[model samples]
Target: MRMLKRFFLIPIVVLVVSCGGPELPEEVALEYEALPKTLDFNQHVKPILSDKCYLCHGPDAGNIKGGLQLHSAEAAYSELSENPGNLAIVPGKLEKSEMFHRIITTDPNLIMPSPDSHLSLTNKEKAMLVKWIEDGAEYKDHWAFIKPEKHKVPKIKNEDLVANPIDNFVLAQLEPLDLKLSEKADKETLLRRASIDLTGLQPTLEQIEEFVNDESPNAFEKQVDRMLASEKYGEQRTLDWMDLARYADTHGYSVDRYRDTSPWRDWVIKSFNENMPYDQFIL
Candidate 1:
């Protein structure tokens, strides 16, 4: 799959933090990667920490090494009570920050992710870490805990092709790249697609003819409603739920024994048919 990357450009002067502490070896100093846009904590810095540093120093207290925690600013920015004046991180002070020193250290005893652990960081990751600290190392609550904010829908060049708000969002990204949505599917094809999607069955010849002949503005929606009302819709939807919930029909202790578990499967189908709320269904 191809990845689409978008950058938000903001004009601001970049400040290089003064290197005030111990000098690193020439080989240890990484080439600085310039920032054209403000670094977002959740999007940029959190991912790097989660992937490379989180396993030992993250949420798992028993596994934590060096009494160091980096999951949030409150936990990490404080001076340790045991060590009177030492601190792990000081936002916007790259040289004073011990974490950065440990990252770029050459001493086998001091370097992290611990050379013996076989975990390593790419030059890009190292450069990003440096840039983040220089930019104040601001932290935000995890996305799951934050309330969502709404923004105005983007205006696109090709508005006629848009049928809904989602289409506008898609076209906003594509218009810049000279890309467009594929040609609209014909009525017969659309009916078949909708039937298969809703009921996991292809449209019958009669259903296709009726859909193509209806010629009403809401003909497609009406056909979708009919498919959704069919018993097969519940059956089709239940297949995924069955797989996820590990619905089984046998007890095997080195011997495969068969037992009736159809009632549980029926329950899932019934829940779908009744349109049970997701939380209620899960519970």
Candidate 2:
């Protein structure tokens, strides 16, 4: 009887010991929760900036702008914690972070690097970076840090109302923000807007008359399409491409020599008329 009672009592003691084991402090549990499970350096951050920024802010380059070098994870964190002005990064805190503030800044004087570089961070990119910083700024591998996953196009309820896939993408994001597309403008308003946007000038009386006369629902689209197909569009596109390519009438050398590249310029204009894809033209 004594032996049987001892066996049953042993089981009860084990159960009680397991159930009443030591508990972790709330603060310690919170600390563990705060740590990021993983980090994505490339997708989360790198695409937000370009090589133009890397020129001065990279490891090899001189740390010119606010002594903040974003070349490596170590360097980035070091600057964040040790900056005298406290104006670069603030790890694990996005709102109180100075790095984020600089990127989203509209003030020309406060802009990063203060250079003529045309590279600008997009709003979406800024938001992603802020979220990343808030998530502890975990250091991980660069590009291809993670395997790519297939993305599916989201389904919309009103297929009849959809104009384009771009609209769908815009709507998907905007819906969460409680925003909707603005109502379509009147024909006259649209024609004026289209003319200025397409040709960089106000519509002529004849153009306006033709647009007003057309009764088709697709008239405005057709008119804009026609304008896009015009020789004027080709000419403007060529000039714009030239500006992008930084082509000048004269050679930029030590002596600032004058060189005739008119034949090349004409060739570029002709290619535009042929509706050459920019990538092919670049090649």
Candidate 3:
């Protein structure tokens, strides 16, 4: 009856664990159904741990359960105190990794995010953890904590099409796919594009006719100037900064209520319309 009862336990936990959750094989023999891409510890694994496991096993010293802190590489990779010879994570060895077994186990008392903790790993998450540990369980510093650095602009073969620094990045992407910029847009199409880009409105019929009739080499430049001169330009441009500027017309937090913030909003639009110097606008 004991042997039959053991066989009825959750599908994966029984096979993953030992006779009484003590003995473990030395070989790295666990299999993954599929690993879609090369897993990165910081990007893929850290997010899962943060959302599900971190509540109990995270960096918070006061709430740490099981006396485990999995917020870093050094601690998780160390030997477990409770189980002298065992480790929570054994790089490239899932068979010997206790964390792997805890996450996979279905036993009410043994599984992590415990039965009453009301947290569980999805099948895909479980697989990702398995793949991560089997691949050596590498960890890295969170991206936010790292200092930022400027990268050299990537060069592309088609220098003729490159109009700005941004185009260099665009063409660099296209070069890999054996692609190039679409043929130069006709004057009418170009004017419409510039009108929409600068003022968020299509070129008026009068504007289209003016652009088509003017054969001057600087006709497109003049149209751009005209669009930038429009008040609509400020309205269109300020939209992108609305969220960045945190432009809300209310007292946010505990008690939300209407507030008169239109003056600042108008100032942003007015600055754009006045063609304020970049530094002055930022200041």
Winning model by TM-score: 1
lDDT of 3 by residue, 28-61 (tens): 2222444445887777889999999889788897
Error of 1 at 112 (Å): 6.4
Off by over 4 Å in 1: 1-54, 57-62, 65-151, 245-247, 251-262
Cα lDDT tens digits, model 2, 1-283, are: 4532221222212112223231223443354344345436665467454444676676664354446677666777663333443434567864455565555455554545344766665444555565567677765554433556666666755455568676777677666568778887887888989877666667788888989999998888898888787776666767787888888877855677778888888888778778776558877
Where model 2 places Cα greater than 4 Å from the true spot, the runs are: 1-53, 56-165, 251-254
lDDT of model 2, residue 25:
32
lDDT of 2: 0.61
Cα error of candidate 2 at position 137, Å: 12
Query: Please, what are the lDDT tens digits per residue for candidate 1 over residues 48-75?
Result: 8998888867878787766677998987
Locate the minimum summed-lDDT window of 10 residues in model 1: 1-10
Q: Candidate 3: where are CA atoms >4 Å away?
A: 1-13, 16-31, 81-84, 144-250, 255-283
Indicate which candidate wins on lDDT: 3
Q: Compute the lDDT of residue 64 as modeled in candidate 1.
A: 73
Error of 1 at 89 (Å): 7.6
In order of listing, the candidates' clash counts read: 0, 0, 0
| Model 3 weakest lDDT span, ten residues long | 22-31
**How well does each candidate superpose onto the true structure, as a TM-score?**
0.58, 0.49, 0.50
